[model samples]
Target: MKDFIKFLRLDSLCGQLVAIAVLSLAALQCVNYYAVYSIQQSYASEFLSVGHDYLASVCQALAHMSAAEREDYLASLDRSRGALAKPFRFRAAEAPEWETETDYYKSVLAREAVTEILTRAGIPPRDVRARVLYGDSPEASEPHFAGYVFPMMQMLVQDGGGSWLELVQPLSVTDRRLIWRQRIFIMAESLICFALVIIFIVRAMLPLKRLGESVERFGANPETASPLPERGNYEVREVARSFNKMLARVQRNLTERDNMLEAMGHDLRTPLARVQLRLDSIEPPELREKFAANIEEIRSIVEQGLELARSLRTSEKAVPMDAAAFAASVADDMAANGGAVTFAEAADCGEPPLVAARPTCLRRAVENLACNALKYAGGAELSVERRGESVIIRVEDRGPGIPPELLEKVFEPYFRVEGSRSRGTGGTGLGLTIARNMVLLNNGFLTLENREGGGLRALITLPALKTAKIGEIRS
Candidate 1:
């Protein structure tokens, strides 16, 4: 129950509104039902005129009958119906005690109605008594109808020998059930309508949902993002219009930024060449090499900055390609270039898995992880394995693993681990960041963790391919 409630997203305005509406309707329905019921049970105040007149007439007719005629008429009436009618002394009767407010009302009203009838008939009222009770056969008792209070009338007389007359009003069990059935049917109809309204409301908000998706897509790939439609209610339409305007402005800014970075990098090459020539003229050999190395670092930084800037633009489009085969090729290329990289076969499938990814970007991310493994662990093993609908490419090495605290920090741009910031590391600290960004743009994830055997492992899992465009890949 707690889990169910925890999962309920009442933070959403739509969910909160629907919950309030349904609860309010249900509370109103319950109150309406109870109000009607309380009023029905309080029927004693309404003065049941039909029952009062019938009881009076029966008493007047009985006063005119002879003893034998009264007995014969009563016998005939007993055979036809269960309405018991006779006169009895007031002392020889069982009095019913009223337990509830409704019962007390019935008792008081029955005594008053009976006394008035007898006094008008020239009979002393003090010698007469009346009581109201409910008639239900013990054999036919049921939980549902046990509390069904049906009114019954009983009167006693003490003119001669004690006797009594009882009149029980007939009740229709089916008719009582029909009243509840009608109420239930109405409630069911109301709930059905409410559900339909909820469904329509959700469908009507679909355009807003689509707009959210478009915004996220643009954030991921601003260069290649398509414009969202100006469809939906007024608020959604306004939001879409504003979002399109913002998207266009951002794209223009990014294009300008990329162009400026390229120009700056291009212009720095000449100054770097001049500095390298100037450093060659130093007198001390060691100092000259050190200055040349510093100049080299500057050049490397400029080239890496340009590469990182270019990678930030996610213009590459994904297509269906062999993911495993692609990783194997990267390993083969690194091996050819004097790097110790080799591919491993998956235990499941012999064939490389086909996935939707940009070949250049995907290869670059894997190549970066492989280079990290070779540099830190001295050698690297690459494996592409299928894990259900996704494919994971594992890059493992047998070198000193990163500190648990600084594992995530290694992926930050321009961040270097302690004692690894020199030219020996062969990076300006943008490799992992660029690789992770490329993986993310292709709808994949990249993570690093310490392998079990004193080494680091990098995993890049790509989502399974479903559909792809048949045209040439975007770059």
Candidate 2:
């Protein structure tokens, strides 16, 4: 149930469109149903009024005839061995339910037509009674229009010829033909209305669909993503335009940083070379060695700064790669370089898990961590495993762990630990910062924590998304 509701959530444009259409259709159906009874009744009542008027005329004709002539006149209209107008007790004028105001089918039109008819015939209002009924009822007591077999009306008139008169007439105004005609009309109306509504909704939401696709494509690779079309509703077009502006700004900043790094590479290296040359001309051999070492230290710092800038301008693309193999290769490479790194694979890592990554940038991140471990702890233990939908890469070192307060601060650029991994080891201090940024670029995160015993552990958690792209953040 929750999943179904989530599917219908109005956060999406399609969901909202469907919801609105359904509600509108339901309301239309309700109104159509409610109007059915009234429309049918009104049409049938018009014919019912005609029947009453005919009955009144018959009574008026009989009143003008002498007692002897009335019998002969009535016989002239007889058919099917029955009289059309029959005599009855006028005392039952108030007995019919339809004559009462509570009658559903009774309307002002029927009443006015009947009243005018009776008055023109010189009949007192109190001397007449009229009602309409359905043919299915035993009390129909009228000549129902056999062609329709619907409801009917009854009338009783006081006769001036020493007898009471009663008349039966069919209230056959609206029949199957009329009702079916109305039905077809309503069906066509509803169909056209809903068709227009659905078409409008689809067209209106087309741009939203395009926007969603653009966002998905953008998140796949921010560096090389194409701008979304600025063709939609006002709000959607604005969003696309804003995203294009933002992407352009990011691209511009990255270009500027790269240019600065290139200029620094050329301008700073010549000065360092000139200083080394000057030291080469020193008189004492011991003094020359000391000065040369200091110069080398400065050169190393310069090189590290360049490397940090290079990390910032990294343009590596992401692709699916085996997590276990990647982690194993990083450790192997470090050990081959005499960095004292060892690799371990968890039992769960039997089948290599694939993750989206930029291999070169990701490798640099792990290398920096391993090298940092070697400086403080002399050795590093690396392990890779799969945990649910995520892959974990942990690098552990048996060194004095960083202080709790400085754990977050250690990720800041140029932040070096004060203990075993101090400045004496010669570092630019941007290792952790660069490593974390690289991990983030690959849709992963890095964290540091002290081991249960006495060591520090760097854990990299990468979500197992084969299509995950580099240099993109999920908004």
Instruction: Quote the lDDT for 92 in model 1.
Output: 22
For lDDT, the strongest prediction is 2
lDDT values, one for every candidate: 0.69, 0.71
Q: Indicate which candidate wins on TM-score.
A: 1
Candidate 2 residue-wise lDDT, 1-475, digit = tens: 6644554478766668767886888698779966986776666656565566666676767767898887766655544224323221112122343343335445344555666886876776635555555757665444433332345455665566545555554555334677788788888888888778766776676776666766664554344456777887898789889988987887677668767876787688999899888986897999999888888887877777777666654677777787788888989988898888999867864445778778998898888898888988899999887886798889999999999898889988778988666778777688898788777667777899998889899999998753344224222
lDDT string for model 1 (48-134, tens) is 444556656666666778878766766776565423222111122333332223445655566577668778888645344455545
- What is the lDDT, from 0 to 100, of the residue 237 in candidate 2? 85
lDDT of 1 at 177: 68
